[model samples]
Target: MAIIKLSVTERRRLSAFFTCLVLAFAAWIITVLSNPKPYVVKEVLEFRNTPQKRAFRPLQSDTVNVTINGTGWDMLFSKMNSAYKAITIDLHTLESKSYVVLSSQKDQINSKRESDQQIIAFNPDTLYFDFSNRKEKRVPVHLISAVRYQRQFFQSGPVTLNPAYVIINGPASVIDKITSWNTDTLKLDSIDESVVTRINMQPVKEGNLSLYPKNIQASIPVDEFTEKVLEIPVRVLNGRNIGEVKIFPQKVKVTFTTSLSRYAEVDEDFFEATADLDLWKKNGYKTLPVVFSKIPDYCHIIKIEPRNIDFIVKE
Candidate 1:
């Protein structure tokens, strides 16, 4: 069959319809681009400074999961960004019955120029906090853990610590968690009788925790306790001609104290005493000064301690 040609009026009507459709499409595109729909982004948010008691250990983690809203495209492109750092969370603001709701800030938004308040939604409006109030107590800091000792020494016994107890104040919820205080090892070894010394105290791991005194005091006992009287003989070193020399009452006295076990080890044989004889040779003097030779390490001069003695040399 032969096709029938369209009338001018019919053609005009079809053209008008096509033009209207194009215009509507263009308007729709502009509107969609100008006013984009919002998007939601999930991020880990942090809250800090939740009031911990001074005697309590500071909690290491304070982060919560949260969803943020922003530009649809921005959220689609990058939903998760940097790990959220905690904005300060004041624990003091919270009461036993309720929690404080922090208002979202402008900078809290996940996307640029988008308000976090507008796009963010929290699963729970406020996090529930549980606390048990505790009465104040003075608990002693015990050095229960044995510290590592230095090589060549053994700890004689349990070390005595000064001001062992600490006054702690916290809520009943937290005070129950505490146990006792500990310390680093005190080294005792190869120690002589004079080995009386103290060690420093160890620091607690928790920052919020408090002790009576910031420092720990410790004392280590040594095993050096013996007493002995040693008879020491004195001699003159490097002497020459002697016309005439005489020492009145010669020998000096010395004493030492150590443990009974090691008493035999302490004796006059441990030290040397001597006097200079060069003056006799140089002066060719008939009379010279008497001098003592060596002194023992394990002993000290007693009542008859002589600093100077007379000596005679043959000329």
Candidate 2:
């Protein structure tokens, strides 16, 4: 391959143009090197939950460290000044019975005064909050679901709950306007007895609502119960035994309906209505004494069709 060479005049013009280009580039570099861009050194404000062992308070004062950066003229232009902004700490996200370190730095801070400049490195990357005020509040709890009852014989009573309320407190902005708390949905498919369960409390947010104690203690007592058909065994008590006495229907039959709640306390043999078997035997087979059985204090024999019957003795 043959190399093409520039002519004498062409070479001279090209050389001059090259020299000018190099000089322009060198001038640009010098300008940039001599005057650097301006920057600011503001405090890296980090907040910590003070009373380190105890829970964090809503209001507290935190310390901050500020520094500077960039050219002297840039600093003069910046007019370094302290920055202040409303920082919000949400307590709702914190775990129950837990502590956390939250912080807020100047997200977008520019020096308002001259002679202020940013530093490449910030002073004290973290800040400590001297939290002092401890606050707590009683929050109301509301029920949301209905528990279903079991079979026809079973009955569902009013739902009962222990410590139906909770208390929460935090920053004013986070604690103000908290409405109410609710438990998870309760479903009773086919329960005959009382039911108990531990449910998580859901918080209602009206306005920034914050919770101090994250986990709420819950207790539900389920009553194990079932309906029972207790047969009241009628027995003859405190009556003269007549020899060779004849009685019709040796045992009086009684039927009644009651709650399974009182089933355990019910004693069919205790229910009794006096029947004069001796009187019947002497009266030539007259009306016999009919007795009913005793039942639990809370239960009642709603219906007793036949209170008395004729007594006959077999000879």
Candidate 3:
């Protein structure tokens, strides 16, 4: 086998070329690390391990400013395109604490760091929170309806709700103060049959509170009703130095319509028909309309036997 060897002059030239290549690479790295630039970024604060029996509400702010320091090469080569970032805070260590000082531990504030970039500082050095004891309570629900019943239709009884009350769980400061909850506004016109629908509860828009069963079933009991005539007595009063006023009829036949369930509840005693004598004293009108009051909500007034009454003052 024959061996090929370079001349001494050629060997020295090749060695110098290799040395210059290594020197250029070393100088580039040294320049990159020598200078560090600062940049500011914002991130959301995410809380972790929140106590099951307590809620921590932000009293100051929910965002923190982060100051990062990194080399020029690190900034260009690393992944700095993170659009979203969150600083998760562990609450198990807080333990019924109102507030805590942040920046105490670098591990607490976690985020994406590009290359050799390091977090220099945070805008908020401390975090403030309001802690409250959690509680559960049962509160009644009310329905808000804009219903126009048919000509001969009415509500049989109170509107029945699938769940009479909702079990609410939240901070004692909020749960203990709530007595009842109402549903969203419902509109129904010319309703002649039963209505059933699911409605959302009024949300707790403020404070640290939670509502169970965000939506509930609502049922309205509707049925056909008949008209009934009742003889209600009339009373004339407010006569002072105006002499005894005698109404032509002492009783009036009041006609009203009510559902079958509430038909028995409607009677003459539940109605008030009166002829104010003050009208005769002021203008001396012989015929005056009888004012009817105390009409039951379940019953709709159909008509009165005699809308107007004739009266004579006996001096």
Q: Backbone clashes in each candidate structure, one number apiece?
A: 35, 38, 0
How high is each candidate's TM-score? 0.34, 0.29, 0.52
Selected candidate, larger TM-score, 1 vs 2 = 1
Estimate, for each residue in 25-109, the C-alpha lDDT of model 2 and write its tens digit.
Answer: 9988667645765444333233323232233432323333345445545545445544542233334333333433332323323
Predictions in order: lDDT:
0.50, 0.48, 0.77
Comparing 1 with 2 on lDDT, the higher-scoring candidate is 1
lDDT of 3 by residue, 15-83 (tens): 999999999999987786567867666767766565667765778767788776776655554446666
Against the true structure, whose lDDT is highest? Answer: 3
* Rank list by TM-score: 3, 1, 2
